[model samples]
Target: MTLPAPARFGIMTAPSQVDYADLLRVWREADTVPGIEHAWLFDHLLPIYGDPRGVTYEGWTLLAALAAHTRRLRLGVMVTSNRFRPPAVLAKIAATVDVVSGGRLDFGIGAGSRPDVPMARREYEAHGLPYHDGAHAVSALAEACAVIRRLWTEPEPFDFTGEHIRLAGAFGNPKPVQRPHPPVLVGGRASATLRVAAEHADVWNYPGDDVADAVRRGALLDRHCADLGRDPASITRSLVLPVSYDDPAPVRETIRRATAAGFRHLVLMLPAPYPEGVARWLADEIIGERPV
Candidate 1:
């Protein structure tokens, strides 16, 4: 199937269970490939899979290093966890990356790990961070999103007193290179999150393989947008799917289904121990002549 207009193709190299050299290699290769328009890293304080003690590089730090090394690929953490750091501080980190990359920054964020998911839940406890209920999380996420935008664009020092977040004379210097701030990409599937996306996101990503589910969640987002008197089309739909090294057929089929479902931002997830020239191989095989 032909990709729709304004479609994009990018790679996500989850920044865990791998070394910096390996990630840099794939990103540098992707930098020169036109089919690959963006690159991503994931935020996790500990390895969520395999051994808990496996090597895991911090997302923003690694992103900064990778940004300095690569020349072209638009880059960011796939979806930064709002619970991991205060929103204002995160804004600063993201802006610095935008400067480092010469404005090639996509700010992706989410409401952090779900308390119901044990794998994600343990990361919070293990790191001595508080784990809040879903209600609290969703509300705080909204506030954090607002705070982040203010930190990125407000001209002078300001204060905020949201129920979940409070600030005093907060301000940002050396603002992001993107005039209004880098494009905000919010990732989540819940109805509450979709509402936040309707109000704040330039892109909304569904991180699963369920095409039917994506369509359903997308409809929910459309309703949310309508309720807010906003255009649903304003938020670009994104899908995050894993890449099969030995078989591109299944991935290709998923891509077709997702595009037909109105998802244009495809984030092809690459597993660890990346092979030589995998980026070029992706261009020739999976993304061949897609007009992205």
Candidate 2:
């Protein structure tokens, strides 16, 4: 009935190959469950799984709709691809979501997916979105974090000149409801991305299933933090684990392992077609039952 100290839980439902009605139902149900403190969606323009032409909702747009529909669960794109939109434009989009969600936005971002991942690459090519190399992507992502934060917090319009980003008189009107901006979550395990997280992220998210690898990456982040004179503990370590409907044992064990491993922010990713009362099941089964 009690969660381990400092552990926070949430859910992620990717918008690809999933119907809006189903996604809405899950979010609405999750909003009432106290065990789940936050929710997330991934960003991708095209279907990366299932049918190549399956319907895919834009993360921000779908997120805004979910924000309006849910009264509580903190929400955001798991990691908005930095290459998808200009930094200033993404800032405005995020600010609007924060306002809509009444300040429950956790701004998660990362460098775009690598060109080697065909699913990711095809989407870029299909949409005419350029896929940059790792170095360029990481550098641009760093500049993006800086520029976006300034847009959210700066009082007046200002010009910016960075190696990867430049803006003239860029300003955000009707600032986000969260003062000094929403919590910034940078997601990735790459060393360069970790360096960016050390400098800018309030929370750093590690993708995939390998817990030990994530811990190793976290150590790398700690080193990066040291180099920047930032306390390693200042950044929350987050990781995602997949949920299984047929067997809750593996998921529960993963949760236990992850929490014990010092991953305080745990996001349980639910595979769809989400079963009936899935959120309630998650609370009762996957996560320990709520306190009596």
**TM-scores for every predicted model:** 0.97, 0.97
Q: CA shift at 102, candidate 2, in angstroms?
A: 0.5
Query: Model 1 over residues 1-292: C-alpha lDDT tens digits?
Result: 9535756899999988888889999999999999999999999998889887898889999999999998888998989999999888999999999999999999999988877777778888888999888778889889999998999999999989989888999999889999899999999999888888999999998877788999999999999999999999889999988999999899998888888778899999999889899999999999887533
lDDT minimum window of 10 residues, candidate 2: 283-292
lDDT score, candidate 1:
0.90
Native-structure RMSD, model 1: 1.9
Instruction: Provide the clash count, candidate 1.
Output: 0
Provide the lDDT at 2 for model 1: 57
Q: Which sections of candidate 1 miss by over 4 Å?
A: 1-6
